[model samples]
Target: MQLLYACVNVCVFLGGLAEEVDEKVLHAAFIPFGDITDIQIPLDYETEKHRGFAFIEFELAEVND
Candidate 1:
């Protein structure tokens, strides 16, 4: 069985403006992590900019091993 773990502390670059960052970009960046099961990028309600980071859920704990 594969043990799942959540990966955090992803660094995202703001494209020109802070508001340019979106979920789609975050998902694409993390796509290479084959064990990733899901991703969530939160945005500021007023600024609509990425919080500068995201939470990635990995399907396996030993992915980096």
Candidate 2:
């Protein structure tokens, strides 16, 4: 599972998310690894809602590992 933590940028895909997931929740989850550069949660255009996936970018590249 450490391999999953080793990336400056990672795209997290959630499975069967019961509710809408926001950027704050994702940021908190990744903060332990390193500084967060940015977080993007793609939402549906028609419904204007989260798509159950997010992209997290860390400040340092080495933090990915």
Candidate 3:
């Protein structure tokens, strides 16, 4: 019997980011590394601003290197 395996990519976390940073900024900064699947920056409802961190998902796991 043969088995197949599927690799899963992991999301990269960036902390200490400026509140002014947004999805666009993150994209521009990370796009050069590889194709980005998604970018998420959690925000505070009260201030309606980023929570000083962001998550970046690259299309390939190699980009993490």
Candidate 4:
């Protein structure tokens, strides 16, 4: 995860989310912060369920504090 973070300019870890949350919802929630380069919501391959958290990548390294 650190490698992925390093490769990206700016990133954030959003947690304590409900199980129903998906990538699009996460993206919408973070737009006010800055330009979103990527949004990842890991899924359970066996259960086909969202893991209840997300990783958001921003366009620049200074997008977040």
Candidates' TM-scores?
0.46, 0.63, 0.74, 0.75
All models, RMSD in angstroms: 8.4, 7.1, 9.3, 4.5
| Comparing 2 and 3 on TM-score, the stronger one | 3
Over 1-65, each residue of candidate 2 has an lDDT whose tens digit, in order, gives 33323344554444444345687777777799887777767667898887666667767465454
How do all the candidates rank in terms of TM-score, highest first? 4, 3, 2, 1
Total clashes for model 3: 0
For model 4, name the residue pairs that clash.
Answer: none
Model 3 over residues 1-65: C-alpha lDDT tens digits?
A: 75222224657888999767889999999999988887878778899887888788878655353
Off by over 4 Å in 1: 1-21, 61-65
Ranking 3 against 4 by lDDT, winner: 3
Candidate 4, 1-65: lDDT as tens digits: 34433325577887778987888888787899989888877777888987776788888855465
TM-score of 4: 0.75
Cα lDDT, model 1, residue 48: 67
Positional deviation of residue 64's Cα in model 2 after best superposition, in angstroms: 17
Query: Tens digit of lDDT per residue, candidate 1, span 1-65?
Result: 87233455342333342455566776676667655566666667798666665566656545573
Residue 60's lDDT in candidate 1: 55
Give the C-alpha lDDT of model 2: 0.65
Q: lDDT scores for all predictions? A: 0.56, 0.65, 0.78, 0.77
What is the RMSD, in Å, between candidate 2 and the native fold over all Cα?
7.1
**Candidate 3 clash pair list:** none
Cα lDDT of candidate 1 equals: 0.56
